[model samples]
Target: MDNENNVNKYSKEEQLNESRVNHDDQKLTTNQGVGVSHTDDSLKAGNRGPTLMEDFHFREKMTHFDHERIPERVVHARGFGAHGHFQPYESMAELTKAKFLQDPSIKTPVFVRFSTVVGSKGSADTVRDVRGFATKFYTEDGNYDLVANNIPVFFIQDAIKFPDIVHSIKPEPHNDMPQASAAHDTFWDFVVNTPEITHMIMWLLSDRAIPRSYRMMEGFGVNTFRFVNGEGKGRFVKFHWKPLLGVHSLVWDEAQKLAGKDPDYHRRDLWDAISKGDYPEYELGIQIIEEEDEFNFDFDVLDPTKIWPEEIVPVKPIGKMTLDRNVDNFFAETEQVAFHPANVVPGIDFTNDPLLQGRLFSYLDTQLIRLGGPNFHEIPINRPLAPIHNNQREGYHRMTIDQGVTSYSPNSLRGNAPHPTPDTEHGYAHYTEKVDGKKVRERSESFNDHYSQASLFWNSMSNAEKEHIIEAFHFEVGAVMDKQIKERVVEMFNHVDGELATEIAKGIGVAPPQNPGGTGVTASSPAVSQENTNQVAATRKVAILLEDGFNHHQVTQVMEALKSAGVHSEIISKNLGMLTGVDGQQLEVNKNYVNTGSIMYDAVYIPGGRQSVDNLLQQGDALHFVNEAFKHGKTIGATNEGVDLLVISQVEGIELAALDSQAELVSKMGIVTIRNAGDMGTIEQEGYFSQQFVSAIAQHRHWKRKNKKEMVPA
Candidate 1:
């Protein structure tokens, strides 16, 4: 193969670098690369009449700007992307012949796009909606795209109903009042009418919809696919991407506040984490079942609205993917990069899953319109790392310059060049499964049982999680003005759990169902609960509430401890400048109360200093910050004189350290307090105090504090 066709000779980054332009010291030019001498004024009559068409430079500039915007994606429009690489833990040649998963020594370049499903390009990031987690792997065989979602189950079963579901959940066409929210009448009406959406509604109302970070959520292939091994053995498979950081979510209230305060909160978090070298990592997992055992499950393996309980079929970790580089250009890369489920390699194959079948067509069709034309694959970000020798010719925005005269096959003049690779040579061959089904538009009976997994998900939730779900239902369902729709929602969910329906009824002003139906499946999957996830202090952010006259030694000790634990601490004061400590030590402030609030941080901390606390006690913003953090169940820490600030705030129930005590610590309900300023200075000598506080931060939130949260007023 020539150098141009031999992509393996250069790394993916190197191939992309061929197109990257510095533009720092270069002269301005038109699209044809012709130099432009004058651009400020168009060639016109007397410099003010109608612009002349002969002003080629001005016309080119205007034409490019006018056509700069493409049609935004119908769904998953609000997205962020990053460049990374995937490496397998060990060889998986026994299961599949996928080159990326068959060798631990190779790193396949990958691009991942994280997005919200039901929003426009300008919607808020913290909206309560299913998130899109799509990855494009540039492998030796070809580009393998793993199109997934944060939630395992989808709202609809058949692809034919996709349009209906999307239309119903989107804002009503007439008013379009609510932006990026499901709390409306049309959505509830659709839910009550579609019983198949019962299970997905349960997940949508759960905390999973409002993830704390893309780095902290799990991505599921959703559709059941097939894995074909080297010997032509095929197995049904479901792919999973598990974050190394435990799955976490923002409290509903916090998520709402963040939507208003910072619409780009998630985008900023990802960019900042990567810039700070805190690369996000997720392990790739696959749940495989023998093709013969497909009929053994209670629910259809091909149903998109069901889950193969991890308790039944455990997820096996296969590889890991780390997103270490952010995209240099949002529009050129993240927006233009297209992902299709049909973009598969030799090992990965598709199932007869109805949703998956529709996606195979819908994704490609949409990309053709969303992007300019059929040549979108030639876009640098979407190009593959394998050799390209197809006879495909020009289309809109075609970048390739073919040299052959015989574009057709079986031609003798060009010796039939660019011949197809046979199955023996690793060419993709579809699994040869017997198919004798009817042409009628119908679904299998095995996909009928939808409430069993929904019930299982509800039963698996901890008490705190259950409460959050109930509240979420209240907010979402209660927004409906039509009482019939609200009543139908309660009746529909009654099948999942009688108590859940009753709780939802109480909040939505509906009478409890006299004969609440319940699914007989009493089992639970522990893996579905976020409470069981691993918690670590690493990558957590803390707000250090400091002011003029702060304790230098105490602040230094706590900050150093946080650094050692891989936690990020930001010094926030009344102003964004150097703050003077009690002993004349100066500390730089990263943020100020005017620009930031407790909603931005995972926890709050205040160091010892009589003057600092005195000043904070008088500032309404500082007190509100503490009160709001406590109200949201975030960990709160105060040392010595700083303890007085906690006592004076709206926080209650937890006993704080007494002022006169010497080096005493009081840790309760995620609040850590040290009574002695001297003991805080001894943090390096006796690290127990800081360790306890760090452990509290690792818990993410102290839900026990919810009992008294209603009493606090921020």
Candidate 2:
């Protein structure tokens, strides 16, 4: 069933819409709604004289403007949010009594914020860093928050070490030189000292750190929580959000170039997608372990730096969320929204996960300062649809005006108003988890094995992913000025995998470990590899290159096929305007070479035309576009005379149909070429070619071409 049909059923979106104000045809007014006759000059004693303090309007306006800015979040500062609704595919009543999960007919209104953990408010979005994937579900019971991250693991196992890791990964305080990067001496030094972080470091260096788009990445709750049923039976659970588009990532080169070319690349992609009705969708999956089976695993269930292999405990998808609406005002909604991990409704409870226990307090504490007050929840985006009634009174920016003769409970004056709720009435009840432990600052013994999973992660990687991880280590560790720290990093990783450490040492100028021994964990989890992710051409963007005298029939035929396959195409040429084909067919260009580049698209296509090919061959920009795209392993398509341009572009190591061939279609190394395409008389024949092109794009990247990519000049 289509999720788009349920967009208007969300009460949260309708509530937010009520707060939206239009400035068109409205008179200027002050905070107290006093209509002002003048506001520009402020009430002055004379035209050039000193202004008087008696001008109340001037004082109020200036005061509001001066205090308009609030403190930005310390981490996850760069965030983008969208509104959506979630619906369960089937009732999960057997697992949890959470009202939102128990009902299949109810659509829970949700607001999701995607962010980068280490970046400042103004930092670029494409930085290689952990991304925050926090979601707030406004249910009938209350607001249930699922605060998560793009990576399933974290750097430190305990939350108390959060500040230290943040300090080391952030720009060095002395110079603050490397903005939004972990490539420095401090981070490597921390890595060498903190052995438990080895598993997370492996993930950080992988392609998952740099997602192709926010819509394509995965989300994990990171810490374990509890799912309590109506019978009070509890199970350990971990949350996951799997994007329907599949997991994809950008190459290091593309990410670096796009950071400078467009700092807001991720947010722009999300905004544009929703505006065009190409809403992002994710299925909510849970990995659950019965209370009795918790100790059956070798690793501690409470450790935050570990993942339960999907093969062992498969992910059961419970519901789906569709982000069908964009925020009307970024500041009022995306900026002001608050999320706390402790925001649980009935049937959801916490575990003894130390990292999660620490976050329970930290998230709320940070929001108090960042959002200016505890009353931040009163903000339209954060306010829940459930009725809120309590004895608690006013604070800074409190929107509610409580009325009663008595504000305290247990008084005859008001007959005990705002009484507590029982379990039968859906009141939140903490699971009765037996606890018998001493209060001490010590970690459990079960949390000590850090290298086993790290080795498993290394073993699970496909050859292409392994190569990317090694190159990532080269860039990150190679930036460390301290040679001792670099050598120590190599040694620390030796425990995870001998070959991985040796390869890391090769790039960072460190000697290979003297005793390069792995954890001897040979088992691999195929689910962790991006090579096994879903592949589809839907929502993929393709850039169509054309100039005057392009083949209109070929362009029209291929574009129709792409559209039918749910692909978006844009005409990119030397200049913006109408281009006349050889057959006198005109088409408008969406972007010009000066304003856009090859990095902005997923793939490239060139339609055949004698004049267009001749003109493109002369322009260095056009050849560079083709070469650069090929270097990045993106799909490239050429039809008829378009094949001549690819040949001149010097994308070698692949066989292409010769210019004289008879309707030959040569598909090799993710490059599709057709010779004598004008000879095709039917759309069916053209569709076969288009189908091959789209299928190539679906593979995301042709890693087999990486070995030959270095030969390209661009």
Candidate 3:
């Protein structure tokens, strides 16, 4: 096994370096390879004269710059991508004949792009929208793209309504006001009219919409696909990618704050994690059912707005994917890599889901315009490892050279070579499902139960999760200036959960909605909630705000422990320069108060020292940092004089411990303190404090402590 693994690794390395040899010793030159002294300026009559047209350098440079940008994606414009490998945990020969899944030893190279659905290319990361989790596998068969999303369900039932749904959620046409947000009149108005979107609206309004990090979020294909075995037997399957770190989210306030504090939070987290060898891992799980049993469920299996409950069909883990490499260039790789749901291998096939069917056309059409013509597949990043042979050739940016008399299929020309392969012999064959129905524009009755699963999702959430959902609804509805739209939306959601609608209405200072009714389906799936997800402290960032005369020894002890535990800790002060510690040790500050804020970090730590506390009090932003951290329910540690700052600021709900006492204060409330810097030895052993902090960070907010009053300065 070791020898085989080494051989495969060597082959991959060789392939990666295959295109690098040409540039090894090449000198800098233009496209013509003419060595020029200067490339920055064009040949002119004089220094301040008009540039001459004879200077091809300037013409070429300006021409390239003029056409540098292509059309951005109509949806999911903001995205981050990484390189990775997909390895099956065991042979899935029983389910499919796809080579990538049939071999446990082979590591198929993959490129994944994570994106936001509605935001443009320049929008902020933390927004209330479905995240696009698309992966392209360069398998020996071809490029297989598992285009998915963070949510399992989509807004529209059919592809025909996709454009309408997108248009409604996008900025209002009259005035593009609200970029990267759905909290507006048009969105709610659409929701009120479109009943099929209720289930997805529940997901969009939940904490799942505001993921803490890309590494911690779950991914779902959102559409049912088919798996065919060698014998032509097929089964319906839904794909799921469960993150090892588990699903987590930020508080609405925290997300809003981070948008300003760190707009590149998710992208930076992914890049930093991969660079540090803390590669993000996700398990590929599939919910499979017999093709004949598709009608056995209460809802239409082909409906994109519905989900298969885990209780009915368990998710079978098939493989694991680790994103271990960051892209070399954002434009060349991340921006140009195209992912289409229709890119399937022989073993995998598509279903007749309206949205999925539309996506099959949309993705290819989008690439043609975005990547320039039909040759996007020829791009290095989108190219497959296997050889591509076809009579279809030539387009804008064509990279391949076909040297044969035959450019078209069929006939005795070229001895009828490059012929099509039969399905029985390693060829893709569509499943022979009988289809005989009258052509009509209508939806299936099974797709009508939009409120049941939405209610199930509501019922599955934990208390904290439910509170966050209510807060999200309040936030979104509060932003709607139209009173009728807000009322209509609340009334529409009342059918999902009367309690939720009433609570949101109260929070937003609106009248409680009248009960429109429910689906009367008393079922809850615990898997739908993030509270039951796996939790770990790995890759969580803790900001240690320090100033001159800080407790160097205590700070170093805590920082070392956190670092050893895989928690990233950075010292933030009022300046980027070094500050003298209490013991005269100079500690380097990574960020200053002007650049960094508590919202950008997972937790906050304030080391004790008289001068440090004085400096914190003197800086207004530093005091607001502590106040904001406290309000957000982040885990905060302050020993000795560090506690003095908290007290001086009169931060609400803080229970400080007496100096010299090791008794932990607010042990179960997410706040931790050792009272003295010398008592740092027991910090890790304080399991109670650890549990509290972890739970607090996981909850992401303490909405119950809603004190409208501002903090008082002592």
Model 1 C-alpha RMSD vs. true structure (Å) is: 16.0
Q: Compared with the true structure, what per-residue lDDT tens digits does model 1 show for residues 1-714?
A: 687766564543443354255767788787899987654333433311223446566445544432323698878989999999999999998899888899898999999999999888999999999999999999999899999999999998766466667778888765575888899877888899888889999899999999999989999999999999899999999999999989999999999999989999998999999998889999999999998898898888888899999999999999999999999999999999999999999999988787776677668777877787899999999999898998889889999999969888988888888887999888999988765543333456677887898999999999999999999999999988778788898899999999999999999999989987789779999999999998988899999998888899888888888888888999998888899999999999999987889999999998888899899999999999999999988999998888899988988999888667567778899999987656453234444568788889999899998889898986
Tens digits of lDDT, candidate 2, 380-435: 99999999988777888889988877788877887787788989999988888555
Choose 1 or 3, whichever is better by lDDT. Answer: 1
In candidate 3, position 131 carries an lDDT of 96
On a 0 to 1 TM-score scale, where does candidate 3 land against the true structure?
0.86
Clashing pairs in 2: none
If the candidates were sorted by their lDDT against the true structure, best first, what order would they fall in?
Answer: 2, 1, 3
Q: Candidate 2, which segments miss by more than 4 Å at Cα?
A: 1-70, 679-687
Error of 1 at 303 (Å): 0.7
The candidate with the higher lDDT, 2 or 3, is 2
Tell me each candidate's TM-score: 0.89, 0.89, 0.86
lDDT for 657 in candidate 2 is 80
- How many Å off is the CA of 392 in candidate 2? 1.1
